[model samples]
Target chain A: MVRFENVGMRYGLGPEVLRDISFHLQPGSFHFLTGPTGAGKSSLLKLLALSHRPSRGLITLFNKEVSSLARDDLPAMRRKIGVVFQDFRLLDHLSALENVALPLKIAGAKNSQIYQHVAELLEWVGLGRQVDAKPPTLSGGEKQRVAIARAVINRPQLLIADEPTGSMDAEMGLRLMYLFQELNKIGTTVVVATHDLGLIKRFGNPVMFLKDGMLTTRKQDELPSQFSRDGG
Target chain B: MMQIIGKSAELQLEKDVSTRYLPVVIAAMIFLAALAIGGLFSLSNAISDWSATLTGNLTVEIAFDPTADLDKKVTDAVELLSKTPGVAAARAIEQEETLKLLEPFLGRNAALGDLPIPRLIEVIIDEDSAIDLAALNEKLGEAVAGARLDIHRPWLDKMVLLGRSVQILAAAIMLLIGAVTVIIVIFAVRTGLIMHAEVIQVLHLIGARDQYIAEQFQNYFARLSFLGALPGLIVAIIVMFIFNFLVGSLEASMLPPLSLGVEGIIALLLLPLMVALLTRFTVRRVVLGSLERMM
Candidate 1:
């Protein structure tokens, strides 16, 4: 559902952080994006999330060219792409339920429908009892789950998670991964960016490895057994 | 569940220390604006009253001449004015009444009948008839020496001009207050946008349209402006009433009461709503423009 070709990005007169990045994600496909620190994984996710414009080249999402899309069209396009940020980014004043309900509320869903759907999703993310708890009152893992719940509440066509399982325990992390897989099976294209090689190995998903602003792909079997978590 | 003017839900702008006193500033601005409006409408009504009272009315003044009979001169002027076309009635003002009119300037306890006071003949013209005032004045002057027609035009014109100038000044003050309010709101909204930049970015990435976020800021700011405007308008009204009371209590005050007619009353009542709408429109523009510069 997404295609990027020769996409280069920079931050205002700076050198390109991502250069000549080319990739295509088929509908319902799931891929793990692994890279070292400052390798531009977040920048790539930003582009996928339609948060920034690439310095050069083309990006097409759901058959529409990203660069050519009008500003007014971005919100509608963004509604179809769910992004779970690394830091959670949940509004501190809003309860977990309200945070998760934001997407539906923005999409103009009825309050009755929004709260019901949000409650169900939060419950699924193991945050049912903490629905009324604000982000400041929640733990790191709880906050991460709330963030994930918020991202997928709209049932977006494409789900991009940046270090989705970084703050959680292994069991909880695997459970959230299965949630992503279930969404993938239901036809949501999934892109998970992480530095956790161990989790990547267990997932056995196709890998898109980024290093020094470049991207290279490999199957799960192609990775060396001794690959380091630092992405060396 | 979106309120037009309510708390900023996601941003939680109500708790910000930066904008805590913004309503007070807005209240002060609105207070000045309301006073300006009151002056504008009060001056307009006073000018209208002056015009209506002076138009088509004339006064015949016979100057004091120690050797001439002032009573006879007044009688002749009244007779001449009565016979003139467009003249409805002519009656000479009594000396005692004329002296009483001057009592405020020339004290009531002053020595009686010592000064050579001129005689005045009040003349009323027909509403529909056109009277040649110059021709009548010449006839009266020829028939009765030192007799002159005081049409009240020169004095009325100067008073009207002064009133209009004050009205213009009041209007300018209103415009300045409006400009100041807009600028203050812009600064507050910009600060809000800056302080909540992180939440805004998060909202944007999560598919919230710029309008959605702008509404939150607009609504919260509008609520503040509306709440602030109420007290400002009320205090202004109370001040105006107190001023009118002071004017009324004066023995012979030239100052008119703060009588804002029908339109002014309506405008005063709508001040709060107008300020709220203005804040809403301004905040929306500032938020949208700032958000456009983001992603």
Candidate 2:
């Protein structure tokens, strides 16, 4: 669950990049965040993932205000959530299996449990044969899948992917979306940001549209397409 | 069977490529440090041996007198020393032996028989004796005219002070070398951190503890320090043995043998271990400090 009220953010001495943003997400909910380039969508997701401190406003996560949490306490809170970066920030020195096993190791899972769960998950993600391959040797789509596997390996309660399939073909993007959708079906809250309108129609998750740092919902009456839906 | 296990210590992000230079830096620092410490210990032991000899001895010199018989005067001084309460033994140095003692300043074949060299009476005293030098000098003067008592205590004091000063200087140099080692390690760790920053950032984002990340770097540097210091220590000891083999006899006549006793050997053997721990500590601090800046 996340709540942001009047949240504004900026780098030092710069004009505000995200201004007066307020949104709410209930537990076990799914939403698609849509915006054109330079729409501040990534900045907003950063605030949600607790990676950046907002210049002003209240952001609450899991019913507790994030600004009030101590730095030492942030890791435990972060471990509860998963994030997929646009760059698929996999460690190049690590093989695909090691990269996927990172979250479990950080969580102090036993070695045997990590091996078993990570192997099974990599096999499920179509990276079964590339488990020993490093990121530099893996294809773009394979790296993306490794990133997704690492993100969800711990079954994080809140899963966020920023441009998860941005570099993939249409079918590959759809297949990755199905992976996220499968995670959602298993009751993991999912939020994905992308510019793909066709994929939006295919998935049919309610869209949260952002332009010039402001968020608005697309209602059924306002939509030109037949799939407009209610949003929470 | 072909899975990559994610042990942070096995992460080669920082250890790769830097191995070529890090060991060389550590080895050079260690070599200088070991040489300084070895010389310091050797000087300290030699000074103690010299001090003990000086503490337990004195000398009586009878000036060469043409009017009086010089041998009789030297004999009288030796007789008096033998009868003295705290005197242990007294013997007159033969003219030939005195000529050999002066060979450094005078030519080996110089005619010393024609020159007016003092007749020397060597005196050994009981270590625990409380003999008063002024009273003993008065008694020796009354026994033989112009017989001078040289107690060696004040000269020993000055020599001891000079030896201490040298030890202090050697210790200061050793400490400077140690500081240089720390700085080198700091620079090395910083470079490694910069090269591996991406891996570290990903690790941090994945919720790894600062200590968990630091262990990877710390273990790497500790092992490097241990291995690097080994060659330096080995080379330094080898140099020591070779130098002694070449000039050992000449040096032994001037001072005690330059040997590392039990304590010195233990300290030498432990140098590499201490270097390892120091490197580990320095690297851990740098890693944590840099991570704290990130936060």
Best by TM-score: 1
**Ten consecutive residues with minimal summed lDDT in candidate 1 chain B?**
B1-10
Q: Predict model 2's lDDT versus the native.
A: 0.83
TM-score of each model, paired residue for residue: 0.92, 0.86
- Residue B199 CA displacement from its true place in model 2, Å: 1.6
Query: Each predicted complex: what DockQ?
Result: 0.77, 0.45
lDDT scores in order: 0.91, 0.83
User: What are the per-residue Cα lDDT tens digits for candidate 2 across A1-232?
Assistant: 8899999999788988898988898888889887667778998988878778899999999888988987787777788788898999888878999889998988899999998899999999999988999999988888999999999998888999999889798888989999998999898889999877777777778878877778888742343342233321
DockQ computed for model 2 against the true two-chain complex using alpha carbons: 0.45
TM-score of chain B of 2: 0.82
Q: Write model 1 residue lDDT over B176-217, tens digit each, in one string.
A: 999999999999999999999989988888888999999999
Per-residue lDDT of model 1, residues A60-132, tens digit only = 9999999888889999999999999999999887899999999998888999999988989988888889999
Q: After superposing candidate 1 on the true structure, give the runs of residues whose Cα lies further than 4 Å from its correct spot.
A: A221-231, B63-73, B83-86, B99-117, B126-146
Clashing pairs in 2: none
Q: What DockQ does model 1 achieve?
A: 0.77
